[model samples]
Target: MGFDLVSRVRLYKVLERIGCSPKQFDGSPSTPSETNRGVKQGCVQASNLFGIYFAAMLRHAFGGFREVCGDFRLNISLKKTNIMGINTQHPPNIHISNYQLEAVNEFTYLGSVVTNDLSLDTEIDRTGSASATFAELAKRVWENTKLTLTTKILVYKVSILSTLLYGCATWNLYSRQKKRLNIYNLRNQWKMLKIKWYDHITNNEALQQTSIPSIYTLLCQQCLRWLGHVCRMEDGRIPKDLLHGELNQGSRPRG
Candidate 1:
């Protein structure tokens, strides 16, 4: 059942009262005491175990929700509810109203497939396949004698590339992954431009003709732009806090 406006407001109030808030952490103090050092180390460990913390918090939140539902005499559909763990080895066991919720390794949310490993390989492959399918669907546009090359390129960028690059701003990419995406993009560009493999046209030449950046460059730009936005967010924001949170002192991961 759907909640009316009043019930929604009551639910929000209940959550607020139960302390269901976003997590935040500032840098640890620089005190020299042994206790202070231990506290700092514990904080670092907790940060590393994000999956555990997330699952625990979810359990608490759902417990509060159950309480609120009982108070309001509302029935929750256990059959429709499930829990998914991300980047977690052991999935959490959550119970609502004496019914244990099933844990899933993979789930779809907002049209994106998310897996427990938190790797973007599945999303990237699905997006690439969708882009290729879209390209085939628009083959007539690419081959149409009446449409100019510029028009075809515009169509591809608007329809095909947008589908492929959805949610790319938050992707964590490495060199190998970037190379794979770039190769796929280059092949798509060649196909759209009607350049055969035997044409002897290089990837750079194709990019120059299309006036577009490499897929890696484009993703980098988007990620950097998002980073700037998060940095500029208010201090209390979760993204801002996570960006500036206390991190283990070590070399950062290579791109």
Candidate 2:
């Protein structure tokens, strides 16, 4: 196989490992396919970061680039359609009978391509200490009668509501209490998160210029770059070299 094909297959391998199916992708070799791939990957990247959806939860499966993008794009469209009309009636939601908050909490570990710095207790003022922060949030929770009176109920409610709304929850009560356990869970599962391919390529180029020749070195450098990009709330853009026709004809894909 050619280098470009190998690279594309590697990308497919990465996607496969993350629970994205090759069969469901609909992207073609032409412009339409590429554009759709970009959009579908973009949405999955968004959903991954927000702790709501999982690439693994995709209902259908595919085997190639088109299959991957088409499957995901269709699913995203269905979600949008379901939530479109105001007061639209949705199917009856299943009750959380055997739902343990701990099970769903695994999602918090899968990091997103984007990050939000908003606090749950945004209105409360923190006096610059960890203890102070907790105190303020507690005060705010108390001030909100709905929160205070139903702390227990809020726990279950949020867990259930999040699952119903987005289909996943990791900040649930049982998961919340097991800090060490959940923290560990988050660390281990992060690799399952989608790779920021374009950003990774750019950073790899920079590292190569600096004489960082090893693949391991490039991956480490890119991971740090990825984290910083996430901290700053940025989308992974296509590498300029590839766009400007600098990476040779092969790496740039031709129609």
Candidate 3:
């Protein structure tokens, strides 16, 4: 809700579309293209279809990269490098220096699921399960009478909510997804607080006892906080551009 000023869907799409040619990237014709993290192998998000130019760019970008003070060369692990088509049904096989990268429908990046469908359902579902596991594993702590309710709530936040909200700031949440997450959070709370369905404790009353805001509010705060960080970025920064930039030409193919 707090992200009314910026479209999370648009921003996420652009993040996958942002990239540059090798020459434009490192300011040298022979140098490999550098990514935001500057790692030897990092994600490169192309703005166009995966085809000839994209393959060529990858080849050029993978060469001439080495340690600054040594002759060490970087060898990319083809097993780890995967390519996928975002909206297109058929993406061509991309060959880089005689090695063809594998194509996938989805992949896990930084502990989150990324799919061609551009949806967060899988990630959210997985996180919900993980949070439930976390809560169940701490059953003893939840039932400890020696521990105050405040202490239990703090543990819940640290152990379960932390896992559930990982990378949530960048999520594009719809009403259905939001409701699903809230249901998971509420169920976890019920178990932790030893509230049975027959107890007839309203969800609001349970929340009031724990003094925890709804998952929707927590998500909004996270998104707004990240937006503030992006707003302060200098020009030509990828995160800032991903938030405000648009493709110069060509639209993504229909699925």
Q: Which candidate gets the maximum lDDT versus the true structure?
A: 1
**lDDT value for model 1:** 0.71
Which wins on lDDT, candidate 2 or candidate 3? 3
Cα deviation at 20, candidate 1, in Å, is: 22
Model 1 regions lying over 4 Å from their true place: 1-63, 72-75, 87-90, 248-255
lDDT of 2 by residue, 1-255 (tens): 001111233344556676765553566443424422322445865444322223332333446533554444322232112111123344223222332222111112222111133222211111123234333544354244554333623542243222221211212223233333323223212211222445444433443333323323323455566555555653444443233336535574553
lDDT of 2: 0.32
Top-TM-score candidate index? 1
- Cα-based RMSD of candidate 3: 12.8
Model 3, which residues run further than 4 Å from truth? 1-72, 96-98, 246-255
The alpha-carbon deviation from the true structure for residue 234 of candidate 1, after best TM-score superposition, in angstroms, is: 1.7
Rank order (by lDDT, best first) = 1, 3, 2
lDDT of model 1 at residue 141?
Answer: 82
- Note the residue pairs that clash in candidate 3: none
CA lDDT scores, all candidates in order:
0.71, 0.32, 0.71
**Once model 3 is optimally superposed onto the true structure by TM-score, how far is the C-alpha of residue 34 displaced, in angstroms?**
28
Ranking 1 against 2 by TM-score, winner: 1
Candidate 3 lDDT over residue span 155-221, tens digit each: 8898788888899999888898999889988987887788998999999999998999999999999
